[model samples]
Structure formats: structure tokens, C-alpha cells
Target: MSIQMEDCLLSYKTALMAVGAAAAYYIIRWFLWQLTVGDYDRKYVFVTGCDSGFGKLLAKRLDSLGFHVFAGCLTEKGVTDLQTGSSGRFKAILLDVTKSEDIAMAVKIVKENIPPGTGLWSLVNNAGISGPLGFPDCFTRKHYEQVLDVNMYGVIDMTNAFLPLLREANGRIINVASVLGRISIRTCIPYTISKHAVEAYSDGLRRSLRSQKVSVHILEPGLFKTELFNLDLIMKNIYKDFDAAPAETQEYYGRKCLKDFTWVVKLMGFASSQFHKVVNSHVHAITAKYPKYRYLVGYDAHCYFWPLMYLPEWISDFCLDIEFVPPAGAQKKKNN
Candidate 1:
């Protein structure tokens, strides 16, 4: 064989050996982790936004595992619903994270219910909203405020309120960010901004509180089937924004442009609907002896967004080039 061919053959063999070693290491590690479970019965966990999605499922999962669960819900109905699923060691508290008074009330309730000797063991901040679905021009200040209040400020507000309890026990805080946090897309500016803030906040908190022994974590999941990604609901929201726009504004953006934008959501139709990945990840983060700093759920999260986040801006944009909007003339013609 020529020198070039020999070099290529050697490189291929080295790659194969590396892949085999990685596979073996991961397989063994998975089994080893399965044997490790934290002391659940003695731990108290507070989960926010337990009305639905990840919060509801995680609360139920943890409760089943024998952790004392204090679930926070926004409505009486949510509280009642969560209560029905759990009994004894579980108590549902009405909490609106945006309201300091409500958070204070929740703190009082949790303090009253927790086991006498143990402080809080874990807090899962899963409440979030995608906000208005349209271009930056299509939204108002209120639209941005509504999302940031819940998605960004809500987590910060709750963390501050619960830090004392966390410190008392050397606890863990799990913040649910998104793949969008890693890669800011053209769509949903407010949601992206809020998640990015969450990423920054969680990282800062993790380092700042390292000495205090508080392990902060982030959950960055790609598209999943949840109320946040409900198709009919999102379509209705887009229509409302479109109809509310001024006549001149509508003419400028055009109907075809709106349809083109709406169709982009279908890209997530293939996204994993099985939310168990989130539950499992959260469970490990809460129970594992050494949990990861960031638990990335879903293929798109690790395979696409994770690597894209490390790439140069030009390269990242190149990957997203296929999704780029049509040229001006083409869009105008389509509108006509």
C-alpha cells in the first residue's frame, strides 16, 4: 500500500478502537449507576409547577420513590389534582412564583410539613411558558414581560425564597432550560432570551454556592410533546397575533410569510413524545451520588444543539441555512 493509504488504514483502526472503548465504558457505567440510590425517605423535595408536564410527572415519580414531596401549583384546581395523586408524605401548596407573598406562604407551609430534623433536599424549577409566537415586531412589551415573569424571574424568585432551606441541608436545585437556550433561533425571541438567562443564572449559582455545597443543575431538553409545544394552541396564538397587527403591518409581513413561519413548528413533529426521558434524568439528578451539571434530554439536544453551541457563528448558521426564509421576491410572489 502507498504511504497515504497506510496512514488512512491506521487512522480507521484507531477510530474503531476508540469507539469500542467508549461504548464499553458507558455500558459498564450505566449498570453501576443503577445500583446507586440516594436516601429518599429522609429527604424533602419541593417541585414547582406540578399542574402538568415535567413537574407533575417528576413529583409523582419522586413521591413513589418515598421522598417527602411538597408540590407547588398555581391554581386550586392544580393543587387538588396533584393532591389526589399523592397522600401522607405529600402536600400540595398554592404558589405563584411571580408573587413574593405566594412564595412566602409556600415557604411557611413547607416548613410546617417537612420532617422535623431534615431541611429541603432538592428543588425542581420546571414552570415555564413559551410566550407569544411571532416575530419581534409582532409582540408587545407585555408579551415579553408575561414570559420572563414566569420562565426567568419565576425560577430566580423561587430559588431565593428556598435558598435558606437548601443551605440547611446542602441541597440540589434543578432548573429546566431548553435546547433553545443553547442555540437562539429566529423564532420565539422572548422564550430564547429567558432560557439563556436561566442558563447563565444556574451556572453562576453553581459556582457561587460551591463552597456552601449547593449543587445547581440545568435540564436542557429539545422539542417534546407538551402544552408548551401543542400545535393547535400555538396555531391559535399565531393567528391572534396576526389578526391583531395593524392593516399596514399585515400587508408588509403578508399572509404567505405567516404561513411559512407557522409551518416551521411541524419540524418538531418528529420530536420525542415520550417524556419519560425527562423524568429519568430528573430522578438521577436528585438521587445520583454524582449528578451531571447539565442533563441534556432528547437526540436533537445532544446531537445537534450541544455541538452547534460550540461551533463558530458562521458554521452554526450554515447548518441552519436550509431553514432560512425565502428570498424577498419569492416571498412577495407567494404572497400575491
Candidate 2:
């Protein structure tokens, strides 16, 4: 056989070996990922935003799995509902993440309630609000601050308040971000900004807490049937903000642009009704002996938003532009 042909055969064999090794590595990882902590009753989890959505669902789930759960709710009804038929292990405290008093009160309640010896096993920062969904300039700094207070700063405050407990248990922090953190959209500027901040904060916290034996994981879920995606409520808020805009700003944008807010409806049409994906991701992040540092949940997150995040900046901008509804004045500015 010719020397060149032998070299080619050798290269083929090397590629096959590499493929086999890669396959084996992933298979082992998949198996190990399924391993979970056995002491459910000893593990305590604190989950915020239990008033509704993923937070509420996860609280119930962990309770069923025998973990002592501290569910931070925003309303009396939220507190009453969870405590009504739930196990004694499930305690719901009225907690609005935006308020310093609420957070401090919650910290006291958690400290008072935690079982003897075990510290908090997980802290899930899930409370968030969908900010005004209109043009960026249509809202003020206060508008942005409202959302950030819950989504970004709230996470920071919760983590800081509970770090001592987490360090004691060598526990983990599971923050709920969004795919929007990786890719920004024009209409949801405040929400996008907050999630992006969360991504950065989670990364930094994960690194900083390594010595403390505190693992930080982030969940970047795509759109889902959560309160944050309530369409009618969202539209109402958007139009409210639009109406409040200065007269000149309104004239420039034109009422016609409000019609384009249909883009939000279309976008939300893709929201998955499978709440379990997010809830399960939270459970895994809490219970799995070797949980992933980042959990990207939902079909849209895995198949579309995550992939789009890696594309060239121009390409991503183009894709996002296709979804953005421009203001009436945008054309005039472009023409000039």
C-alpha cells in the first residue's frame, strides 16, 4: 500500500477513536447527572416568588419530595393557599422581594424555622415582574428600577442575607434568569436588562463563593405560561405607559405604533405551557449531587434563543429587528 493511503487510514482510525471517547465521556456525564442527594428531610430550600408560577410550583414539589421548604409569597392569599393543605414542613411567609423590610422579615422567619443542624440547602431567587413593554424612552428610570429591584437587586440581597446559612450547609443558589439575558429585545428593555444583570451576577457569585463551598446555578428559561407573560395584563400596562408619554413623544410614535404591539402577542404565542420543565430544572439544581452550573430550560431556549445567542452580532441584531415593532418616527429619522 502507498504511504499516503496508509496515512489516510490512520487519520480515519484516529477520528473514530476520538468520536468513541467523546461518546463515552458524555454517557458517563449523563449518568452522573442523574445522581441526587438522599437526605431530603434534612435539606431545607428557600424559594422566593411563591405567590404564583414556577416558585409556587417548585415549593409544592420540594415539599412533596420531603424537603423543608420556605416559600416567600407576596400576598396573604398566597400565604394562606400554600399553608392550607400543605405539610408542616412547608411554611409560606409574605415576602415582596422589592422591599427591604420584607426581605429582613423573611430572613428572621427562615432562621427561626430551619431544622436543627442543617442550614438552607438551596435559595431559589424567582420573584420578578415584567416591566413596561414599550419603547425604551417611553418609560423613566423608575420604571427600570422597579423591575431591577426585583429581578437583579432582589437576588443580590437574598444571597447576601442567606450566605451564612448556605456556607454552613455547603449549599447552592439557584437564580432564575431568562434567555433574554443572553439576547436582548427592543420591546422588553427593562426585563432584558435585569436578566442580563442576573447572568453577570450569578457568574461572579459562583466564582467568589467557591471557597465558601456555595455553588451558584442560573436557570435561563425561555418564555413560559407564567404570570410575567400575561398577555392582556401586559398590553394594558404598555398602553398605559404609552398614554402617559409626553404629547410630543406620542405624536412622534403615532397611535399606529400601538397596533404594532401585536408583536408581543405573536411572541407570547410561542410560550410553552409545560411548567414542569422549569420546576424540574429547579429541583435538579437543588437535589442533584452534581448539578449543572447553568440550566437552560424549555424548547425555545435550547433550540432557538440559545443558538441565536452565539451568532454574529449583526445576524443577531437582524433576527431581533424582525421581531421589534419600530416607532412611527423611526422611519422619519431614517429618511433624514
Q: Per-prediction TM-score, please?
A: 0.87, 0.96
What local lDDT does model 1 show for residue 293?
91
Off by over 4 Å in 1: 1-37, 246-248, 327-336
What is the lDDT, from 0 to 100, of the residue 194 in candidate 1?
94
lDDT of 1 by residue, 215-280 (tens): 999999998888787778888998898788776667777777788788886675677888999989
Q: What is candidate 2's lDDT per residue for 30-78, written digit by digit as tens?
A: 9999999889998889999998899989999999999999999999999
Candidate 2 local accuracy as lDDT?
Answer: 0.90
After superposing candidate 2, which stretches have Cα over 4 Å from the reference?
Answer: 323-325, 333-336
In terms of lDDT, the best-performing candidate is 2
Question: How high is the CA lDDT of each candidate model?
Answer: 0.87, 0.90
Question: With candidate 2 superimposed using the best TM-score fit, by how many Å does residue 244's alpha carbon deviate from the native?
Answer: 1.1
Model 2 / residue 41 / CA error / Å = 0.8
